[model samples]
Target chain A: MLNQLARDVKASMSIYDAGDDKVYGLLAEFAHPGELLHAAEAVREAGFRHFDTHSPFPIHGMDKAMGLGNSIVGWITLGGGITGLSLATLMQWWMGAVDYPINISGKPFFAVEPSIPIMFELTVLLASLATAAGMFALNGLPRPYNPLFYSKNFARVTDDAFFLHIAASDTKFDRDATAQMLEKLGASNVETIHDHGVEDQD
Target chain B: MSTASTDKTLAHLADFHDEAPLVKGNLTFHDITEIVSSHTEKKTPFAWYGAFSLALAGLMLLVGMIAYLFWNGTGVWGLNNPVGWGYAIVNFVFWVGIGHAGTLISAILFLFRQQWRTAINRSAEAMTIFAVICALVFPTIHVGRVWAIYWTLPLPNQMNMWPQFKSPLLWDVFAVSTYFTVSLVFWYIGLVPDLASMRDRAKGKLRKLVLGVASMGWTGANRHWRNYEKAYLLLAALATPLVLSVHSVVSFDFAVSIVPGWHTTIFPPYFVAGAIFSGFAMVVTLLVIARKIYGVENIITVDHLEKMNIIILLTGTMVGFAYITEFFIAWYSGVQYEQYAFVNRMFGPYAWAYWTMMSCNLFFPQFFWFKKLRRNITFMFIISIFVNIGMWFERFVITVTSLHRDYLPSSWDYYTPTAVDVLTFVGTFGLFFTLFLLFLRFMPMVAVAEVKGIMPEADPHFYDHEGDGHHAEHAVEPSTQQ
Candidate 1:
């Protein structure tokens, strides 16, 4: 009963129904990465706060075109690296000097010279872990479902296609207007994506 | 080759400005996806089963031998008085050395902006992970009391004992584990997008479901790719230093000792160069077979193999120079023990192994100076095998010859590896091949997204023939400016 309840809660958290009055977004299919990049720039210029571009591979200048700033993953990695350094140092000093000290060939109990390798290793390890975890967290990944998956044409996003999506929740979003705007920006196959499928919090 | 270059045509050929295509055959994005994914999507072939069965048998042998050692103790091997470190340590170093090329290609070359690395880096990184696994096994089982291996770690045990931080072995424990973890993370980060591509192409419900979760619903969003690319760059930077240091610490295992043969300041750089040398050779060995079997010749082209050969030539010479420098230093130091160690290696019971190392590592790679031979698949394969054999013997000569005739003639004894030692060594190859075979069958052996990213059409400017003024500015990646 508890397992079933947990599953129900997760399902409720994820699913979004596009009833007669609701939609997920306006999805526009662009011909190529160059067009999609320009479309993203145009969408941002039109004051749409919630818009995204999708392509098979990362298009150069897309972040700038979309008015996005530098990624914060580097800062997260730095934080993780500092934590690892502190923990590794403390672990070694306490274990060697404070907790259970043993004399080894009359060498110092907690010398930084000897501890550098482990300290370096731990720092890199933690920093790398934080980079990966921060990337996944920032992207809101492991989301097995998305309303965008409902479109059969959208399957090609991982192939050769380029796409731009403006969510219905955006204050600037009018379904027909967004479609017309995307088409004006050189997009084809402009369509409204309904939210009957599972969706996550943007 | 020089004879073919006529004076009139030489200038024209040299002035040719067009770059060689990174991908051959003019394959579309869908074609690359299909070519890589078909191995996973299609039915299992009989040959794969046959090879897998052989590998499994070898894995079983490795397990059985290890269990036998656990039951029978270290005495089962021909480890005598001074030669306590035998095949186990030799194999440990050899396999660890073989694992270096992947990170060198993926992390180091990526940082250097070598575009060709994209094609081979995925499979090479996979090799690194598997080779490290094989390398880790030797040291784990080599510890006589295997159950008490936890003592090597820094857990709060009741005994109140802590590992010696100053010891190179403890440093090794930290280094190899960290290397493995970081490599795994780096490899996975690269795999995510490719896995998402696979998830989209997946047909069966189970395969799709598994790949979907594995991919973490990666939709290749611009915002996500921004962070994703930054994370990749950071990881690559971290991995570069980590790879260099891992082998340096491994070399510290010997160099820290006062033993005449093992003690030297040159060991760190020498060992690192040798690691890359052997690692690239191993990559060449596997890729030569894999590209043919998987029909990915265009992806991992002849040019890729030739570049690897040049690296082999470069590092092979570096290793040879190190060897000669060791001899010069040994004699010049005027230490009789160090001098004797060098002399014994050349004119001792294991002189055969020493000569084999010299010929395989130094003599054969010289053939790569000829462009024709370097590009010849048959010649490269044979030389790669020679380097692999030579590198294993190099470790053997270092470990065994150094010990078989130490300072005291009274206690010195010949170190002959018993059947158990030989079989256990052979078993690691089985373990490596088995994991590698599974990876080839299940995963995208060539990095699909990365290869696509490098294609001419992938450029946003590729389709901009209208002489658009803004494209030139957009081509300057803001990330690069940062």
Candidate 2:
């Protein structure tokens, strides 16, 4: 539940400086997934480590391009499903067998046939909640604002543009070298965004 | 062809992105403004909405009829001592039957990986909710002492009157509420991404706030996408069984009893198939009109309709098979009461209803075997309506005819639907259309983001310039769990 802006607040401002001051880097603008992969390589080759590529849709190979690995969504879903199953089993057993005993047509109070509906409902209910909660947790959702919003151009991201931002925090981040790499990879437009610091934030 | 299909699909994906001069692909801020402002809100063509309004008005009339029936007692309907259920149960079965296709389309199609369903799933789901609402009306109203309806629920009231847990009617309460809630959640979850798509594109503050909260702070992160997909898969899995259980329990209401006509073993699957048959027929009816009205020809193509009509035929044949089986089994069992009931159906007092049910459900769907009629919008629409009529007749044949001529001839009496019965039936149609039409107006009827995601052209690889790099990374072996 970390505020996206709060998490983003800790991010060091990324500034890629081109050697000749043309500063064309900002690889996020690449339209093709393939271009993004090459751009990642170029960043690696140029010895910059803190860049992220973003697009409106997940590209087939974008994870590998960004060197990302397995998501925790599956584990979260499994944990949720287990919790839901146990809770349901407990609720049904307590209500039907222990708390109050009621019989219909000589059937057992906790007849599995009748309780199947409840058990299934609980399983689904629990699994769905877990998925939602897990997703929010993993995605760091409920983030109110982000510094990325300061660059209005970033909004086009919701549209057609793809982009990459090389942060200054990367071990090999040479601003000039990174910008030069982006310029070579056919970026449509690139801007070096500045941070006004935490004091400027209201 | 495989490579070409892949390339073609991949290429078509990006057709909606926001890049070109007038906003490159998909709905840009401008496209959303235009669709919402110009078309969606543009008074909905009085002729079209006027027609919808007429249907809605008729639905109100049905409600009025129900009110009159409830107030005046079950006597307002044509029910006598033997015939307790008439049009109410018929309409109940009809509406509930129609509700099945929605869940089938959404949950089953999702599980089966049928991408073609996205165009109509939202509408189908909404139909499921409204139909269940209509279905709930009957059993509650069918109990003549309408005021004491709450007696079915167990509570800490003054009277210690326990709801008959043994009764199938009580089971219906649980089954229906669960189906409704789970279906609604499944539908809303499906809509979340599209809602986010809508929110991000909205121009005004009113639009922004409304769409924003509904979108639930969706940023479409890869993780969110991953979990969203998983939840959808799980819901689909849950719903697959739910689709079977809801109707099967409803069938148990009749099948558990030893009533001559109603006690057949085939009723469960027969009724289930018939329910799905009628439900799919209704889906076809709605989608045919909706696609034209919404101008989503590409999304809900003729192919989708053709496939649906094919299901109608398949289920209809199954239903027809059940009808024949019922007669054969009744005769073969040689139980005199069962034998008499089967003979009585064809030659009995309400043979018109029996034959009508046969022709409507069995005969009408036969024409769909022709590729032309299945794809032909007008023919398909007319046939869909016929299937609806046929399914209603099927229920009538099952309920009224069976009751009018029971084991003992002296106790037998004919069932007739009075004015209130007829009006209430018409009213249910009104209720269904009023809600369906409104959903069409405000909601993103087609899941725009999902459709966008599936398009092959949407992927950046489709562009002439970027292939080699992405191919290398995608070469990372998939998880070897398989």
Q: Once model 1 is optimally superposed onto the true structure by TM-score, how far is the C-alpha of residue B65 displaced, in angstroms?
A: 0.6
* Model 1 chain B worst lDDT window (10 residues): B473-482
Off by over 4 Å in 1: A1-20, A198-202, B1-18, B469-482
DockQ of 1: 0.43
Give the best candidate by TM-score.
Answer: 1
Angstrom error at residue B92, model 2: 2.4
List candidate 2 segments past 4 Å from native: A1-27, A32-110, A129-186, A191-202, B1-38, B41-44, B143-166, B459-467, B470-482
Interface RMSD against the true structure, candidate 2: 7.4
| Highest DockQ scorer | 1
Candidate 2, residues B136-253: lDDT per residue as tens digits? Answer: 8888889888887787655546753445444567666667766877778777887776666566666778877887778666554443455456667776887788778788778877
Q: Which ten residues in a row have the lowest lDDT in candidate 1 chain A?
A: A8-17
Write the residue-wise lDDT of candidate 1 on B446-480 in tens digits. Answer: 88889888766566655453457244321312110
